[model samples]
Target: MVQSGNQNKRETDGGTSLESYTVRDPERFALNLARALEEAGKAAAAWSRPREAGEKPDTMAEPLADMVKTFSKLTEYWMSDPARALEAQTRLFSSYMGIWANSIRRMSGEPAEGEPVEPEAGDKRFQDPDWATHAFFDFLKQAYLVTSRWASDLVENAEGLDEQSRHKARFYVRQVSEALSPTNFIMTNPQLLRETFESDGENLVRGMRMLAEDIAAGKGELRLRQSDYSKFELGRNLATTPGKVVARSDLAEIIQYAPASQTVLRRPLLIVPPWINKFYVLDLNPERSFIRWAVEQGHTVFVVSWVNPDERHGNKGWDEYFREGIEFGLDTIAERTGERQVNVLGYCVGGTLLAASLALMAQETDDRIASATLLTTQVDFTHAGDLKVFADEEQVEAIDRAMKEKGYLEGSRMATAFNMLRARDLIWPYVVNNYLRGRDPLPFDLLYWNADSTRMAAANHSYYLRNCYLENNLAKGRATLCGKRLSLAEVKVPVYNLATIEDHIAPAKSVFTGSRLFGGPVEFVLAGSGHIAGVVNPPGLNKYQHWIGGALGESLEGWLETAQAAAGSWWPHWQAWIEKLDDTRVPARKLDRRKKMLGEAPGEYVRARV
Candidate 1:
């Protein structure tokens, strides 16, 4: 062996020289290791720290306890029947035998089983070549997939379990299986193992350092950084569409975007985004910004920027948001543009609020909103997807009690729950990148927006969980707002409903079902992707397809069977629909110079960090 003066330049196995690894400084590595240890200690201490006087105790424990109890019932069903338990055990054991047989055949250089157990298509976790080529990794991958499948089937066929209980079981089972994946560990994952060898344990040091920092950033909870957050700032790289805050209230701020065209639609467009997150998602950037796109399309766009609620907003329920937020926007538009009949769009929870308020207003004979566009919104919560697992009576009650302590639920809690919805993509990838691989994530605008969460007011959140999720009062026409019982049947405005095919939060089925609740002519358009991507899809990018001209039948499957798939973004179709309703062009209105400006485009309400 010829040893060079530069020790890192030495050849690896088989005399093939691999490139020198990045972490060659032992002193630096040692220092980082010490720091990482210190941070980890701090993380543990933070977790153990007692709550101050009057501080809210984490409400998650009761829910977790309930989950365990539910699981026990499921277990009892299987355990009660020896034959059933044996059958389940045999199925898993049989799969293991097949995997073992395949391994033996591969070692003997014979053909392996043609139909071997494999990860489902597009399963990114087992994408590495070694997972396919190497015996050890292949076995591990197959074993994991098999076990996860077995557990899933057990829950699926579990007798006498209610839908909610079944839903919770499926969600938690997936979460547990995802958490226990072989790829997450350094020893099991070929890529991480190779990295470990090349770096000489330097990666571990750096990963631990990041681990400590993330825990601290989350204030004892692990706030997984999906992207390099330092690269972003509000109004700098993001939310840059030129505009001004024309209206402000306790609940929300109204931003009137600068008109991109000389002439704009006579009817102004009011966007009400979900208060759970900031409004900037619709206006993320120039390319993906719906506000900028709509402005360029000759429409005056006004968006409601909900204030990140605190204890002061604790009592602000659905009624208050309707009056102060949506009603306020309509009033502002009328005063500024003298256009009372405005086209309105609502996204997610904001959409639900818009529908409810429209019902209330229709009852009062208020014809302020002319047409409505709902984006991935749900008026019904019967099939509200995995999020329902968190909205049961016990959990909601617990959340309400905990929220009352501080008058609001913590923003991080909401962020965590949403992440849990797509844990494999949102949670584990960040874990592997930040903690296991010792690497910071790339700078992404959407992820940056996702991390920026908003607290829920106690009253508003309580009403939402109980009415929409628990009781499903909104869909049943029993949801009372102001002095009247709200019903979607009373609103006669033309509605444009957009649902994404792959939305986890608001399932396409759920969205389709909610469309039937509207009394007016509802044009249900199905977009190609998930919640955010489906809506923010720009026409220039031409990424996904949209399904139109399908009859809204009783079942989502029946509609999909007959739905016509059209290429490109659904924006153009929506624009055409709006034009059909009313396309009278008027000279674009400018912000009033005589009136006071609350702030700039993105507004101070959105800039609220906490």
Candidate 2:
């Protein structure tokens, strides 16, 4: 029995010895080397002939093929890990140098103007697939070849590497080489490539100097341009509708815009834009501007521009926003226009506030408002989407802490947050492309507009996040505004609500759900595309999708009963609905102003940096 036990222990020890063997089998190594050599010979033979007769392969193909051969050779050169340190250090230095060079190019904006940056497609120098899809692929090809040679050398020298370590090192080397490939350069550094080409290789230093000079010149020009209201003159036939500064409130300085065009509506129109951003989003350039479009549409247009918040207004809350911002602006428009009942168009957040104002007006029997049109507005907060993520207690508190220190939330901070939501699509892809590819991205006006941003008052942001998003009281008919328990059900005026299907901020379902809360006739429209484009969408540019509901009788149930379905851009449909309310075509009279002129068109507050 002792002899048998000793024999068993010897057998077990023998098995363990085989497992613990560190050296690779000589025969296996020889066989792998032979196979690799055979493959390389075959590849060389294949390379000698054309894949297609008289058609040349890309310049990168040969280098890439050679790199592949080198990689295969590396797999067979297994050696101790520590013995490969010098080779590894050399590769590391090369990689570090490459990265440093790329960084310098980015900081200085060097590569863009100096050369024909290669296509990003098939480039490995970039980290993102989008960057790889750009036009700078050739630059990536060159970078890859050099990186591959260095990596292959590192793999060839070694002494103590086990199978696992060798395999891991080989794989990582291949990956890193592929990532840094000249072909991949476009993909890796798309932003750099794009910017380089676009700017014609203008360095950052030169660009900054030019920018400073231009800004200084612009400032001087602007100072001379800005004077008395009457002294200022517009270059184009732009807006025949003379605008007069009517009233100045705590938060907004109201201006009544009266167009000289033929009128198709009896009641005057008052445009209420959200205070969250500068009101000029509606009054942008003459062609695409909604305000300009309204004037061309022969409607009596009036816009209320809000006073941007600063340190002095840090403590102002929602109550102040309502009483001072909304009510004050409305009264001024009413007084200046002499129109007892004005048709109101409230866009985005301003629409919600407009609804609240209507409820307040109903309570006070205020007959100034005739009809209300809400564009891309949300009263329901149950599904406000990602914006609600910031509504959590912890996040909100953190934001408040940051805002408290700054007095107001920075516009750049807001822009950064929204940009992060689509970092790959909106931000990072361009960065990698321009910085890595040594090119310039396409300059898009819409992108430029999207880039422009403004800050939100800390007090307003806090209250809005808490009351509307977290508590969700607005849709519940329990929201209090200006010391009144505002109820959507109490609003009996004709209501027109426009929504978009792909709106990231306000989903259509949320907007539709709140339809039940309104007591009067409700027309809910679900437009195609996203929040901004859908609202600004004009006919013939793109087709829009929407659903229409019949007029809501006095009861909410009655509205749901007649709520029929339809489809198309709600603009025309909305136009028809609004047309029905006008009754007669009344000539637009010039609006009257009570207060003396203070500043220019698009008041100083609108121009103020938040």
Candidate 3:
């Protein structure tokens, strides 16, 4: 069990125990406030810098910087109560000066050099008396509402506290109450606040100063906005993995990775990657890459790198994706590897396509697939969580309208929606650190990977939303792919279902339910971490923990009740499972090149860039 911060503190005779509460470190809070204030100063200096000295400053920065400066000065006043209120008076002076200066600029409609300035519709400082009154009244309304709620809750909760605890609580509550008066909130939030105040008070200023120093020293440089392309390189093992132009009706290109000197195994492994992102996610880096590990374990790996969609592919639907994506790729992998049966691994949306292909293959009696592995994929969308929030008719209509204007769904827009689902962690935290703190966010490899996005054909996305997410037809066995009824129950091959316990996107229960949708022998494994981290989990790391239970027949809840602790990564466990199904103990056999002439490996379709 994870320990609470005050775990060591014992309970007292009073109703409130010290162990039950955790106090914020005053010193740390003060230090953080100081850092934030420093940052505010640097931001102010940056705003004041001449256009030639600094790249043209953002028009938004000047007002925000001006408010931040006022907030800092106010904080300086608070540092020593009754210090003649000298800094407080100066802060008031700066705030009014900023307001009047902005007013003059608005009246003139131009800068000193006759340069035209952008009009501010939301600017609070207007010469019109009515405008200022309305803004101030609205600000006071929100502030009073918040202040009343906070005060009431504190009073109600404090009634049960002991003398000592109650006194501390009262002090904190009073401090908060005084801080919320229309004057304080504005002082704290500054630009948005009714008055000039720090967003995080002193901490924001101090952090900003440190960040400014780092930037000056070429360490933590801030980027106000994000870029479309990422700097990360896609790692490669095959020399012929680069894309080349291909003609219509050409055989799909295949990239194979595995160890040398092994006979063609009976079960070749095929990987289906989501077109929403690049195929490199499976082969991210040598250390954590699933493809690299699979090849090293002596399995012939074949991955399909999808063509990034464009206006020309707008008419392409799920039917086309199945034909060119799975069916064609399967045929190519089989013919090249000389294998009668193969193992397939599907990820996210790719898993949905794979399920459809498997149904089609089964209907045709293809006998090429020996087993199938799905990673955090859903066959049932009934309990899909937040993704369900976006599946309504109105939402679908809105999507259709937007897609009609643009042939393909913009990749960045889709990324934005996904990121919004976890705004606090995914968006705001980074915004505060990078923009407000003046520091560059830590470079996370997974986030870098997520940054790499690709467009989806309009038809493909529409069909997926209607059939898979909204209708929930796939799990119900009412879905049809390529005009053929596709049933999950029919694609009954040895299956491996892996889900992360803490996965927000695809919960373990949802993944577990997907197993019941199939009539195959299933092994459901639960891993640690979220969707991405759980998959890319590498071995040999200390403090890494995961729980494992019995295969499909066992209840997941029952297993969790008696689950055993396992050391190291679950990769070895997966490797063992794959080995048991291997009829041939030998390595993979090399395939003849240029059998069908898919132009070249990778293909131009996969290389299309924004």
Return the top candidate by lDDT.
1
Question: Where does candidate 1 clash, by residue pair?
Answer: none
lDDT by residue (547-597, candidate 1, tens digit) is 998888898888888889999999999999999999999998888878888
What are the models' TM-scores? 0.94, 0.60, 0.62
Model 2 Cα lDDT, one tens digit per residue, 96-195: 4564565456445455334333334643334434332322232344355555766656654545555434443554465455444433232234343334
Judge candidate 2 at residue 88 and give its lDDT.
68
TM-score of 1: 0.94
**Residue 275 in candidate 3, Cα distance off native in Å:** 1.7
Q: Model 2 residue 525 lDDT?
A: 69
**TM-score quality measure for candidate 3:** 0.62
- Give the per-residue Cα lDDT of candidate 1 at 14: 22
lDDT against the true structure, each candidate: 0.88, 0.59, 0.60
Task: Provide the lDDT at 59 for model 3.
Answer: 32
lDDT of 3 by residue, 269-369 (tens): 88887778777666656566777667666677777777777787888888888787677666766666666778888887888788777887888888787
Ranking by TM-score: 1, 3, 2
Q: In angstroms, give how far residue 505 of model 2 lies from its true place.
A: 1.3
